[model samples]
Target: MPHDAKAAKAGTRPGGRSARVRTDVVTATLAELTEKGYDQLTVEAICHRAGVHKATVYRRWGGVDGLIADALALSADQPWPIPDTGNVDEDIQLLAREVYTTFTDPDLRTTPTALIGAALRSDLGAAALSAFFTARHQQAAEVVTRAVERGQLPADVDPVELVRAATAPLYHRLFITGEPLDERAAHRAAAAALLAARAGLFDAPAP
Candidate 1:
């Protein structure tokens, strides 16, 4: 692929040729990151995979870390369809299934784990990880908040906490215990979190 110099030089949020280049870079980075662990991921490797010159990768992303951050941001930006099934139980199941699907996706699953591992080992990585999670949490919170407003949930639930509860177990299994991300485990965790929320674990204190 021919590298467009003007596109490479343009601002981060690009249009036209710049946007196409950005998309290509991100796609290439994701492929490299998935195939090779973080330690082995290189600018040269991304450039080779992306069919762009090393200078193009360097000019756009600066380095491997910058590239990974952009890839992660792109992954995070991918739509997470949240269902509002009118019944909280059903909605929670749908959310859990969605998460399970994501965790099992060959391409996506490794990216987050790699990013989180990097975050644990480096301050800069940690900041990037924090930003990623903050965006994810905010999105999840909005879904839960909408559920609460619609009376699909209790009146006083803290959507942020509820979202965390739903996801924490899966993270724990994936990161803490290094267990498999299987369907049974996902369903159990989702059910537990929804049950707890229904039981008022995330409810606001009465005045």
Candidate 2:
């Protein structure tokens, strides 16, 4: 496909050719990272995948770290809405199901899984991964906050902790046991997390 068509398929957010090029490059960067990992990632490969010249990448990013960092930012910018159904149970269910859908998405899951794997091994990868998840968890934490506002959850419930609790099981299935991540699993995760949170399992301890 042509470069413009590739950029369009990559998902253009805004701006002109520069923005589209950056998007394409970042999309390519994530694809390469997911497929080949950080150790084997190269600008040449990413450029080839993106259908852009190597000079464009070199001129803009300077190196692999820069490219990965920008790609991580772009990944973070990708849309993932926080659930707000006004009821805690439903909210938690929405959160988990969204996570399941995202992780099960053939295009999205590999990117994040690869980034998470890279986080454990490389400093740059760790920074990128941390920034991405920190933002994501922070956004998801708002669901618990909204639940608290509605008296659906305890005032002292830790939002991020609740979010973490709700999502951990899905990651466990994805990375560890390799079991099926079905809708049933999503509902179970949300229910268990909300139950635990309601029981004060996620409440902060006395200092």
Candidate 3:
């Protein structure tokens, strides 16, 4: 999960009973996603783990899809992964490494891949995946923003697309190609994205 500080500062961060309940539900939701996957996940099971009544969850969340969506938002609310170290190359490298680390972490490794699979199957899943990526793109775009401010990138660059281009190849290797990811692979992805950005490939189209 990638979270921006700006949003957290705006009061979306939960607290008190709401926080407690959200923590429990979200934790349970991830556990279920990691184990049972989207298709097999059930509200009853999540409630059992969260220790909240099923009706309580249903009334607020509507069902499993709502829980899944909020669970993603909860995770995205964490401190963003992209480092703002003032060097575009280094920042993209850091971003790649962070993506690699997340996809390889035992606790989180399965969830994204599973969600990708889910995204291919249902509208709920597509929406959740979209929201997740939207949050991540927002967070990642920061690195590019820093780069542009420092003149490392053209002012016309699309920050979000730049970040996405950097990470997409890494994800392809991790999830689609089943290839091993290492420092070399990570740097390669970053460099390719940098090259593309330098070529104005990531620039926004003229209005």
Candidate 4:
């Protein structure tokens, strides 16, 4: 029998045994998902890898879907490295370059790529994925915010929109068209986003 969904929504408690358990379980989940892919992932395998009792996982996370969601939720709360170059143009270019490096680098790509691919296979994971991107966008928007403060960008430009514009093409090529991404493409995307922002094309709509 499946565990209650309400139990899964309780979230991981910070500190002590609960925190350790959450860490172990999430680590195990990522390992299993990376090694076996989503279709082959199983609660029993996760339990064995985590070395935590099956009952504990079921009672806290409910099932595989809940585990996946919580994993993404945890990831979202973690700090992402936002660029800090004094020049807004360099910062934006670095932002796009970071994405390109992450997805295209052999050592860095496997786990995150597998995690996102698995997330696309389930509704619970999908919602978590949405939250994950939202959190990332908010964090990255700081680059644009600082640029505006320095008068490098128009005050009316939407920070999140500018950040999104800078990096969205790489994501489209990566997750959609499966096109090969190059350094030139990353630079081009950043340039186009900056040009549009300068032209006031990404100004926040009057509310």
Model 3 per-residue lDDT tens digits across residues 29-126: 87887799877889989999888999889998898777777766676677685697888998998998888777777776687666566554667656
Candidates in order, TM-scores: namely 0.79, 0.76, 0.80, 0.90
Report, for every candidate in turn, its global Cα lDDT versus the true structure: 0.74, 0.83, 0.80, 0.91
Q: Taking the tens digit of each residue's C-alpha lDDT, what string does model 4 give over 51-156?
A: 9999999999998888888899999999999999889999999999999999889999888888877887889999999999999999999999999999999999
Q: After superposition, how far is residue 193 of candidate 1 from its true place, in Å?
A: 1.5
Error of 3 at 117 (Å): 4.0
Residue runs of model 4 more than 4 Å from their true location after superposition: 1-14
Candidate ranking under TM-score, highest first, comes to 4, 3, 1, 2
* Best-performing candidate as measured by TM-score: 4
Task: Compute the lDDT for candidate 4.
Answer: 0.91
Cα RMSD of all models vs. native, in order, equals: 4.6, 4.7, 6.3, 7.0
Task: Give the number of colliding residue pairs in candidate 1.
Answer: 0
Position 52, candidate 1: lDDT: 86
> Candidate 3 clash total?
1
Clashing pairs in 2: none
Evaluated with lDDT, which candidate comes out highest?
Answer: 4
Candidate 2 has its poorest 10 consecutive residues by lDDT at 117-126
How badly does each model clash, as a count of residue pairs? Answer: 0, 0, 1, 0
Better of 2 and 4 by TM-score: 4
- Distance from true position, residue 58, model 3, in Å? 2.2
TM-score (C-alpha) between model 2 and the true structure: 0.76
